[model samples]
Target: MGATPYSLVYGMDAVLPVELRIPSQRVMMEAGLPEFEWAQARYQELHMIDEKRLKVLYHVQRYQRLVEKAFKKKVRIRDVKKGDLVVKFDRAPVYDHRGKFRPNSLGPFIVNEVLFGKAVRLLDQNGETSTEPINLDQLKKYYA
Candidate 1:
């Protein structure tokens, strides 16, 4: 009988949003289809111009870090002998990829003995010699 509240009523005749709305002038202007009388087509197209530029910049920065690490030779196998305190890589086995050979050092493993040219036998935390010899690069110097 009287004007129906929108929350309590709905039907094909419900033109509520268009009829019951009072939007700010700025909102209509930004949508560019304001009033359906005038169209500013360029208004919404400019939003991603800077967004794409930012994505490219971020990728470039990551590439630079990789390049620096490669050139500086930060990761390389070294020759470590017994009684030398060294830190192990400590990365988990889950991270090891096919060629990467993830050797996570536990406790900078004490170099109990150098078994062969490349393999250094280590005294693991359990006070037992590990069956596998660790590469020098997998061993980092241990510091307090």
Candidate 2:
């Protein structure tokens, strides 16, 4: 374990010491080497730091993709199409005062258009199109 989280992730000691312990003389002697050799090794390690950080980033991205794949596999794809009847969920603002038993959703709106990326334009009973496209997640198939 390293003294700090940054040291643990990056595999380098921090510039500022949080705590210190004196090494035993015997341990120091065994680990000690010529100053020039130690400097060269330290320089090599410093040169490789960017590569190590890039590898960590790549692994994190790969892990995210795997998790996304697993999640997508379990999701039920909505089969909405143009002209389908669907109900939009009501997302009322907190300031709006409605009855406790008020319906939590609106519409049996007709699907006027199925746009790109799971969005739809809706039509009310009067055949007027909605002001904006709604996400498919906010709707479900409406059956009479």
Please list the C-alpha lDDT of all candidates, in the order they appear: 0.63, 0.79
**lDDT by residue for model 2 over 1-144, one digit each (tens)?**
427888788976444332123233333335786666656765666678778889999999999999999999999888998889999888776554556766878988999998998899999989999989999899999999
Candidate 1 ranges with C-alpha deviation above 4 Å: 1-77, 93-105
The alpha-carbon RMSD values of the candidates against the true structure, listed in the order shown, are 12.6, 9.4
lDDT of 2 at 95: 50
Candidate number achieving the greatest lDDT relative to the actual structure: 2
Model 1 Cα lDDT, one tens digit per residue, 1-144: 555566356532334363224333445555565565332333333345467778999999999998998988865557676876667676564644554654455585577987666667777656787787777766777766
Listed in order, each prediction's TM-score against the native is: 0.36, 0.60
The clash count of every prediction, one per candidate, is 4, 0
Superposed by TM-score, candidate 1 places the C-alpha of residue 52 at a distance from the truth, in angstroms, of: 46
lDDT of 2: 0.79
